[model samples]
Target: PRLLRAAGVAQVVPPLAARDGRLHVPLCRQAGGLQLAVFAYITGRGGADAPLGREQWRQFGATLRAVHQTPVPEPLRRALPTWQEPGEVGRWLQRALPVWRRQKGRTAAARALIEVIGVRYDELQALTARMLALHQRLGERIAAGELRCALCHSDAHVHNLMVDQQERVWLIDWDGASWSPIERDLMFVIGGLSADLLRPHETEWFFEGYGPVQIDWPALATCRYAWAVTDVHAFAIEALGERDEARASSSAAWFERLFAPGEIVALAREGEAWL
Candidate 1:
């Protein structure tokens, strides 16, 4: 956050410091045992479902460009983790599939998992395999030092973006920040990866603010598939592991939505053509 502010990324809402002078002070735990932290509040209107106008999309593009262009200090560079291919979905499925197959589906969570995975397991496995292969190719490129790394907001989806009263586009959620290929951020913009939030012309307007640059197609494809794979893994975990029924239902719904026509799964598969 400090680095973004220093780089003139005014869209970032500065966190309020706690009594101990720490910005992200951990507070009480939620029912799910997740630690809650407080931060500076911004008066904004946009949310995950908010429709962004052309200007808003352009500003979002510019703000993200600023974030990617921010220089990483030596200490920060060393501390930040580099991008890696996602494998949790594959691993989790490998371990859970056999168990799920054998279970009588007595528990609600077990039933939910079985119902979600039973029909789509093969499709999920095939997609994961394709993504893993793409990642392997990406790994070779990384080893050959063919890609450039930048500060990236790895989860820069619509939910993480907001528009203030002055129409400034604010980027929230920094927990997923990492040193990754610029494509890590770009993938969410160019493809339908923004969940179809930005129209085709709006995407062009976004590039107007972002300016010209060469796109690393291989890196972009990997990032896109990685996001899909990671989301699948995360939602499946929430559906099967979350004790709260409401949360579990929400996860299951999102997991189902991922496979809807022209949704994330199809979008990710479309990325293979770029390879």
Candidate 2:
């Protein structure tokens, strides 16, 4: 939040101190000073329901570019989280795969869901393998100092971006903020969830305002694939935890959309062509 403020980004509104310059205040459970949990209010406009226009998308891209260009303070370098050393999706699936296998064996319902997942298992594995390769390239480039790393909003999907009344684009929810390749941000808007909503010329306008920066296409492709698959994978896992038929059914629908015939294969071919 301080970084955005320093970068002259007026869109971000961080939490303020309740009193004594404390950003969070605790609620007493019984008497006083129990320190159960601290809380702060964040102000922002728009939400998942908000509809965005072309200009907003351009501004969104500009805002992200502004963030990426902002230098990380030396004091905060070690404190801030980083990415592309290992892809987040890879790590998440690593943990999830074992749990999923266990669930499938123990629960008959999980077995039913597993059958649905199995239909696309080969494609999922294929996408995961390609993304892993891209992650390797990203790691090599970062390690060799061939790639310039900067602050990225790892979850910069449309739902997280808020548009104010003045039409200014506000970037909220810094939970996934990390020091990573710029492609991580770009792919979120271009090839991730928001991709389907963007018109072709609007995409061009985004780049126009964002200025010319070379993208590691392989890395971007990896991120793009990871973004889509991670949502479906996470949601499917959540559905199992929910034990609700509606949510589990919805998860299956998303899995189908994510693994649409030839989609992952096409993305793999395109990414390979860039290499």
Candidate 3:
């Protein structure tokens, strides 16, 4: 809350489900709305794929840049868990594997999932083991000059954003927020934005608006596909009546996408770049 003032937001109001990755608040007049900045919900079914206005998305990205630029207050930093630590990522992946395994036998599609994911239980176990190993390896790289990091709105897509009647886009969920390769945010929003909501040319313009930064679509494509797997995991878990478990496992799949190279290369070539 205190950290937000540093970010220029007036306040961080409490919501009924704040801990559950959502915020529902009556809009303050300055919020420029009818009195709510609720967590976005996909209207009419396809869930996260639902419509998010184009102007709203562009504004959302801009808002995120501002939010990311905000400094963390000492007290708030003390009060909150430090996200993006290697230990945290490792813990998250470990915790999520069990959840994924639990659903293994339950989902009729579990077998199909195993095939699509290119892993069996043992395989996933080994892969996750390797992921932890690589986590250690990447930690070394990140600590050295090899990698650059930035705070990211892990769920950078438009669905997690809401624009009031004023058209001021507000970012909602922070469940997956972390410090990662700066490209995580770019690849995420770019890859996941739907055909109806986004087009490649528009996305190019969007990235151009990010000011000055490299836009390697192939690399971004890598991150995007990894995110896609997680998206599928999220949808399936929510459908399976296990929302919390879903979020964790699905998010793991997302991380796995980053670590797993074959998937990334394939996604880049596949033009996971949809409209």
- C-alpha TM-scores of all predictions: 0.87, 0.80, 0.53
lDDT of 2: 0.66
Q: What is the lDDT of residue 230 in candidate 3?
A: 41
Candidates ranked, most accurate by lDDT first? 1, 2, 3
- Residues 213-271, candidate 2: write the lDDT tens digits: 88787767766666655665676676566566666666655655555543433444455
Query: How big is the positional error of residue 225 in model 2, measured in Å on the Cα after superposition?
Result: 3.0
lDDT tens digits, residues 83-170, model 1?
A: 7636545566556665654554434764766776877778877777877777777778877899888899887767788877887788
Instruction: Report RMSD (Å) for each prediction in the order shown.
Output: 2.9, 4.2, 9.3
Q: For residues 129-184, write the lDDT of model 3, one tens digit per residue.
A: 54345445555666786766555666666566554556455566675666566566
lDDT (CA) per prediction:
0.76, 0.66, 0.49
Against the true structure, candidate 1 reaches a TM-score of 0.87
Model 1 whole-model lDDT (C-alpha atoms): 0.76
lDDT of 3 at 64: 58
